[model samples]
Each structure stands twice: as C-alpha cells, then as structure tokens.
Target: MSPSRIMSRAIVLGFLFFLSAPLLSQSLTDEAATIDQLETRLKAADKEAVTAAMTVWVDRVRSKEAELVALVEKRSSVEGDEKSRLEEQIDALRTERDALADKAMVIVKAAKAQGVDGADANEAFLSGLSTHLDLKDPNALLTFALNWIKSPQGGIKWGLNILAFFAIIIGFKILSRIAGKVVAKTMKASRMQVSDLLRDFFINTVRKTVYFIGIMMALGQIGIDIGPLLAGIGVMGFVVGFALQGTLSNFASGIMILLYRPYDIGDVVSAAGATGKVTAMSLVSTTLTTPDNQIVVIPNSSIWGGVITNITGNDTRRVDLVFGIGYDDDIGLALRVLEDIVTKHPKVLESPAPVVQLHELADSSVNFVVRPWSKTSDYWTVYWDITKEVKERFDKEGLSIPYPQQDIHLHGLPTDAA
Candidate 1:
C-alpha cells in the first residue's frame, strides 16, 4: 500500500511480463516449426518418414498440453488484471495447441493411408482432447463422438467403404445375370449341335465365374488384399482336387460324355447294365428313369467306363421277331402271312422292305424270322401289333405252331428200375 512498495512491485511485474512475452512467442514459433516439418514429411509421402514425423509432432503437442495445464493452474492463484492477462495467454496457447492437433490428425490420416501404424498418434491426440475437454460431461462426450463420426478417418470413411463393397457385389450380380442371358442367346443362335445339358452347364458356369470376379473386386474395394486370397483359393483347390480323386474321375468322364454325346436327355439307352431313358445329367452323375418308373442315379465314371448302347440313337430301328411253325404247315403260306401283317402295320417304315423268311429248321418245326423297319419311336408299337396279328392269322389259316415234345421208349429203363 506504500508508494515505494507499489512502484517497486510494478517495476518487477513489468520485467516479468516482458520476459513471459518472448517465451510465449518462442513456444508458438517452435510449434509452427514442428507443424512445418510435419507438412514437409507428409509431402514426401513416405510411410516411414511420415510416421517418424507424426511421433515427433505428438510428443511436442503433449509437452505443449502440459504447459497449457500449468498455465490454467497458475491462473487459479492470480486475481485482477494479472488473472485476465493469464487468461488471454492461456486462450492463445490453446488456439496454438488446437492448430497442432489439427495438423497431427492430418498426419495420422496420411500415415494410415500409407499403411503406417498410427495408434500412438491417435492415442496422443485423443488423450490431449479428453484432457482439455472434460469427457465426464455428457455434452463433451457427445461432441467428441459427433466429431469422430464426421471425421474422414472415422465412421464416415468406414461406412463409405462398406456401402461401396455391397454396391459392387450387387452390381456384379446383375451383370452376371445379363452375361448368362447373352451366352444362352448366343448359343441358341449358333449352329453347333450342343446338347441341352451342355448348354445349361456352360451358361451356369459363365454366370458363376462372373459373379466370383465381382466378389473379388468388391473385396478389393473394401481394402482387402485379393492377391493373397486368390493364392489361398488356388492352394485350397489343389488340396481339394487331390482329396477328391474319384470325383475328379467322374467329372472327367462327364466331360467326355458331353463331348462325345454317347447319350442325351430323353434318349432310351442301355448303359452301365441298366436300361432307361436319360432324364438328367451332371458333372458327377447321370439320372435315368427306368421303364418301370424307377429313378436311378449312376455315377458318370461307371456309365462311361462300361458299354453304352443307345437303343434309340438312330431315327429308324429294326424289330426282329421269331415264329416257329409245325413241319406239317405250309411254309410259303406262313411267310406270306407274316409279311402281310408286318407291311400292313402303319408305324413300320416303307423304304426298307420287311423280311419274313424261313431262318432255321429243327426236328419238329421250322423257325421263321420276321424283321421290320420302323421309326425308333414306334418300334415297340409296330412289333406288338404285328406279332398279335400274326398269331391270329396263323390260327385262322390252319397253321400249326409247334412246341418241343419228347417220345418215350417203354422197354429200356423199366426193367432196371423194377
């Protein structure tokens, strides 16, 4: 309260304030220099350089934060204009620290993009922010969460990546369908005699292949390294192929069957000891519907390895029937009757003449072979009709159909048995 004391205090206070001004200015200049160095390293765009710079920048920011906290604590002990002056200095230092934080965040994002680990930098930044703003306050925590959600390296970037991944997958799925339709149309327009089963296989294969490529692209878009994924897939395929040797054999056999076309859908064929109509075919097995309506699934390997008799491969087939006549009946009349019955059948083919001739002569009867040509589809009908007609006509014409008969001698074995 004395003039001398007040004057002395003012002189000392002015000198202290003057000293603090240069120190604050120096601190700002040093922070600027650190930021500039970080920017230069970022421009280099090297992972190691940027990462090193980020570490240095984080340490500097942490040191500056400690200084800011000290100033805040020191302000609590002051009063009047000194308190106000300290408040201004704290505000300026906080602004400078915030600028450094912004710069650090930029470096962190860039480092992450360059495949550098930014965990330390991120933790340092968040720790500084949490210390500056009381995270115990709900509003502060909400603000922090909002800021993170809005940041480029946070929720927004990850959300965009996820959306892009799904978009790529969906787009590729549509493209695959389009590709399948195009393939089917092209195959239909072409003159190649491709079977239905083969055509379907090709179309499905094309669609699946296109879809798989889309999945790979989607994974890459989501920042996944597809190179290793593809390599792993190849290795797995090799392992699976080695394990499924029998399946591979069936697959190969199926391919051969497709190429050679030993039998096709709806073809009545005798293959692998089973006689049936082919209903479906796959790379592993062939499905058949037997004449009695039994469903049979035969492995392609078995079907291909054994004999394949395509009973209805050609457009026309020959129906052979044998009839035996008694030795007393007129052979010429029987042959004429057989020929008439076969020729009169509507389903029989006219170009190849029917044959009704004496084929063999036995002790009791003569055997006549009745051969007729007909459309493959109508072979059974023609055979059945002609055979029924032949029996009736033979009976009406007084023809004797003979069966095997044995004559017994009474004197030979009777005396020994008695």
Candidate 2:
C-alpha cells in the first residue's frame, strides 16, 4: 500500500496497455482488409459466388457489431483515458461494420438483379442493420431516409406509383363525366320517355361505376392486390345490409318507384301524409317541397306504402266549383251566369265542355256545381278566375249567393217558462 509500490504497479499496467494497443490495431486492420477483400470478390463474382461471399461478409459484420457493443458497455464503466480509448476503438469498429453492411446490401441487390434468390441474406442484413441503427440520432435517420429514397424498391418506386395512381384517377374522373353526359344526351334524343329521377339515377350510377373501375385499376397499378379488397367489400356489404333492414326496404321501394313510374320529379304528389312537389328522389328517400316552401324528406318505404296521388301526372284536370244561390233567387238566372263565366275563361278546355247544373237544394239555398276542364298547369288559374267572375256576374244578374243561416223560433212554451 505504499506510494512506491502503487507507482510500480501503474508503470507495469501502462507497459502492458502499450503492448496490447498494437495488437488491437492489427486485429482491426485485419478485419478491415478481410471486408475489403470480400467486397472486391463480390463485385466480380457470379450469382453463386456472390451468395457465398455474402454469407462470409455477414458473419464478419455480426462479429464486429458484437465487439462494438461490448466496447461501448466497457467504456460506460470506465473514465478518462480508458473511456476515450475504448470510444475510439468502438468508432473504428462501427465504421467497419457499416461499410460491411453497405457491401452486403450491394451484393444482395446484385444477386437479385441476376435472378438469384437473396431473401435469406437480405433478411439477415436488415436484422443486423436494425440493431445498429440509432433511431434517436437525426443524422442517422436522415441518412437512412436518403438511402431508402435512392433504392430501387423504396421511395422512388412508390412515389412513381402514387403519381400514376392520381393520374389514372383524374383521367377516369374526366372520362366518367363525359360518359354521363353522353348517356344523358342519348336518353334525351331517344324515343323512350325516361323520368328525370330515373335518368339522374342512371347517370350517377354509370359515373360511379366508371370511377370505381378506375380506382381498382389504380390500386392494381400501385401493386395492391384488390382481390382481397373486393372480397372484404362483399363481406362488409352483407354485414351492413343485415344491420340496415329498414334502409333496405326503402331501397326496394325506390326500385319499385323507378320501375312503376308512379310519380316523376316536378309532379305535385300527396303521399305519406304530405302534399308537395316532388323535388328530388334517391334510392333511399324522396324529397318534397311543400306549397309554402317547406322541404320534407320522406323514406321511400312510406311513400310506396301509401296512396300516391300524382295531381299533375295527367295532361288535363277537372276543376269542380260549387256556388249556392239564395232560396228566393232565380235558379235559371244563376245557372246561366255560371255557364257564361266558365265559357268565357280562355284556359277552360272546349272539348271537355264545362257542365253547369243544379247539383243540390240545401236548407237555405240552391247549389249549382260548375265543372270546368283545363290543362293541368292552367287548372288553378281557371278555378280562381271562374270563382271571382261568378260572384261579379251573379250580382249583375240580380242573383244572390247565400251563406249558412239558421232561423231561430221561440215557442209560446218558452215564453210561459220565462
């Protein structure tokens, strides 16, 4: 434990360390030389020879990585000069391992280019590389990214495929629009009377189908196997259909509507307890805009389940109006006035002549039913004009229009009770 004895021990240790330095340096040099030799052979070697050389190179790289790891561990426990020296050794070993890995990757790529199966060798190289990669180091990550981008099967390939995918999709999107227009024009030019709802549905369906085909083609171009995708969609559809039975019923009703042509778009329809103009139709729901501009969306099932009165479906419609004259008024004079008012209306159809007759004699008045036929679009116009003119003409002809009136009679018994 004396100072002299400690100094002597330190001198001996220093001398041993000096002797081991050259031996360690020589070992590193030998390993580097072996790696260089293997790389040279790999460059000039055929497929089988490249494979053999790659196996040896991989084993050497693994051994060097293990040594580097041990050096790092040892350095963590030491301090000052010993830690610095171990760090230097670790850096050199790491450089050598990295170069060997680069060589192995090149060899595997070359073998693959020559149609040799380097799957096992490639797998081993990746496994070893993953172990050495410092994910936290920005420089390492950047280097890995740059390398992958430059590789044939990496960023370059996928980037090109992505560009191709978008290009195909856009091209088909334009084509679908053109196809839809063409179909629409054809339907219009042809003799068949296709309803607006059905036409819209067909155009949409065609456009969607064309776009879907394009999507499938783009997926295939991007190296995606869509066979499984379609299968998955079919299964998903089945599950969704089972869950949405009510929606399915609506869909079925929509199909029936399309086939049966009960009501077309723009028709004033009374169905599902709503009276409105048919504004839009889809496979699941029908949209109606009421007279007061309120929007209503009714399920197709409800529409098809009830009575659908398409008010404007026919070309012509009948407007029925009743006018009551006072009991004392002349019935003949009131009837003549009603006939004159209806016949003077230009919108009233001449073929289906207007009928003017005494329909009923009520408690206080004689009722005359005036029926006029006109184009469906002109029906309301005729009805309003006739009602207004009838009042004016009845006054001119000295005929009185009556309202509900009750005559109260008080009996003598009531006066006696009072």
Candidate 3:
C-alpha cells in the first residue's frame, strides 16, 4: 500500500517488458527475412529464358501438329474411316496443346511487361491456378489426362452400365427359355396335331427376334454403332437370297404348310414314296418315321406338291371282305349267315346296317361281298373278324365255301386217242 512498494512493482514490470522487447524484435526480424528471401527468389527468374522456352514449346507443338496432320492424311488414303478418325483425334490434341501454349505465352508476356521475372512469376501463377483447379503439379497434359481420365461417377457408372448389359443378356436368355417352354406346354396341352418343327420354328423365331432387340439395346448402351451392322446384314441377306432360289422356295412351302395344316404330327400319310407317321415337320423338310422304325426326311415342297393319303382321318371306317360259296350250296342260306355274322360283331356300326351281297358269279364260286362299318380304331379287328366268322358260319350252316376249280372236258383228245 506504500508509494515505495508501488514504485518497486512498476520497476519489476518495466524490466519484464524490456526483456520481452528483444524477443518480439527478433520475431519481427525473422518474418522480414522470410519476406525478403521470398522476393529475392522471385526476382532471380530469367524472363528471357522463359520466353525462349515458351517459343520452343510453341514450335514443337506446331511441328507435332503438322506431322500428325500429314500422318492422318496418309492413313486416311490407305484406310478410310479409321484413318480419318485418328486424324481427327490428332487434330484435337494439337489444338488443345496449342491453346495451352498460347495461355503460357500470355502469362509470360504479362509477367515480363510487369517487370516481374517470367519463370518464377509464371511458376507461382501456375501453382496457384493448379491448386484452384485441383490439378496435379506435374504440368504435363499426359499426366493430367492419366490422373483425371475417369469421370466423377466413373466406377459406379461403369459398373452400372456393365451390370445393365449383363442383365439384358440374362433377361433375354430367360425370356427365350420361357418362350420355348410355353410353346412346348401349349402344344402339349392342345389336342391339335401340331408338328415339332412348327412349334420349334414359332418359338425360335420369337426368341431370336426378342434376343436380337435385346442385343441391339445392350450394344447401344455400350456405345456400339448398329447402323453399319444392320446395313451389312441387309446386304448379305440380299446376296444370299439371290444365290439360293430352291432354298427360298422350300422356305415358302414350309410356311405354307405351317399355315395350312393338311396333315398333322402322328398322322399316317403316304407321300413322296414314304408311308409312315409324321414325326417332324420343318421349314425345309418333313420327317417321317415308318413302322419299321426308319426315319425318312422329305422336302416340304415334295410333300406340298404330291398326293397325301391320310389313312386315319375319319372316326369310323368301312371294311370290305370277300368270300365265295359253291354254286351247289344254298345261296340264300349263305347270304343270311354272312349278314348275321357281321351284324353281331361288337365293333360294327348298327346305325347303317352291314351289307352282304352276292357280288359276282365266278368260274366255280358264287362271290359274296361282306361290307362292315366299324370304328377306325377297330378296323383291323372288324375286317379279320368278318372274314373269319363268315366262313365259319357258312360251314356250320352246311353251306360250302368254294375254291376256284375248272371243269375241263378232254373230249377231242380222248376220242382221238380211243
């Protein structure tokens, strides 16, 4: 609380302030030295040297541009589209490099005009600009391109594109498989006589069309040009069509067969020297499997143009059987027995009564015709049954079934011999 004590405190504070002043001054001196060092380094750059380097760079760019143009032109003459495309790329690169050189020259000129060293000023300016642009410090365009080649969404975008492409392929495959299954199932479910070839053709055509569209879409997504591909296919198709006239005719006939189903699968037909069940029918050929397990392939055109005998078309069929009786036997009794045997047959149709007729007078027998109407499925049984039963019944009734015999008189020869 005394004045002396207050004075002593003030002196201690003043001493401390004095000691701190040297430290502060040293700090200020260090900062000033750093600034001067920066200025000195900045002033040491040679503007003339940088200007010369810039001129050399510009000349190099121009020379490279000229060489690229010449090469592109030569390549373009040798190979049309690819060479032209390469030339375009070269021109773009040359233009970009030229612009970069021009920008560098401008920076150098501005620095020189401001009385600032070109190299150091330009270097500092480029460093600051690169930082702002978030570019690497190499200052090499190739390095820049390599470093920033990808887009902002590069990995995800590329993955998505690839995934989409695969997905489309898989989807098309699945669709094709499903379409085939559906076709098969539909054919199996329906009672119509559809050929395997017809079903396959329909399913395959639809699947191929769907797959073609899917492939085109996927290619477009991946940046492919389908215009040239389509044109090439069209030209190739025209050429092929011109060469194969018979094949085209066959194809047309096949289409006609599919549209107008004269005979279906499993139909027993006689055509093209082949009598068998229809196994497969295609655009080009029809396959028949004979009862002997032999496969025969016949052209669709042959089948379309030839006679087709569908043996199993109707639900019911008529069986004709011939039997003969001796002229000495009772003809009325024989006819009655034949008619009775056919009428009692289980498979014979009663709606139209079975017919028994005295067909013809043969050399030694009275020929009787037995006509029995039976289901198509029971044709063989009914035919065999009617023939067998008629003979047995006539025998039981004491009506003799006759064999061909000749009553020849050897009167002239015998009289001459006697």
**For each candidate, C-alpha RMSD in Å?**
16.7, 19.9, 25.1
Q: What number of backbone clashes does candidate 1 have, counting pairs of residues 3 or more apart or in separate chains? A: 0
lDDT: worst 10-residue window of model 3: 129-138
What tens digits encode model 3's per-residue C-alpha lDDT throughout 232-327? Answer: 999999999999878888898888888777787877788888898888877888899998999999988888888878777678888888888888
lDDT of 1: 0.80
Candidate 2 residue-wise lDDT at 141 = 54
The global C-alpha lDDT for each of the candidates, from Candidate 1 onward, is 0.80, 0.79, 0.68
Model 2, 1-418: lDDT tens digits are 9999999999999999777655443333243455445455445455555556455556777788788788766766787777556655655566666667765665565566677676466756645563344455465456556655765456787899999999999999999999999999999998877677788988998999999999999999898989999999999999999999999999999988987889988999999999999999988999999999999999999999999999999999999999999999887878777888888889999978889999998988899899999999998899899988987888888888887898999776634555
* Candidate number of the best TM-score: 1
In candidate 2, which residue pairs get closer than 3 Å at backbone N, Cα or C atoms, i.e. clash?
none
Error (Å) of candidate 2 at residue 405 is 4.8
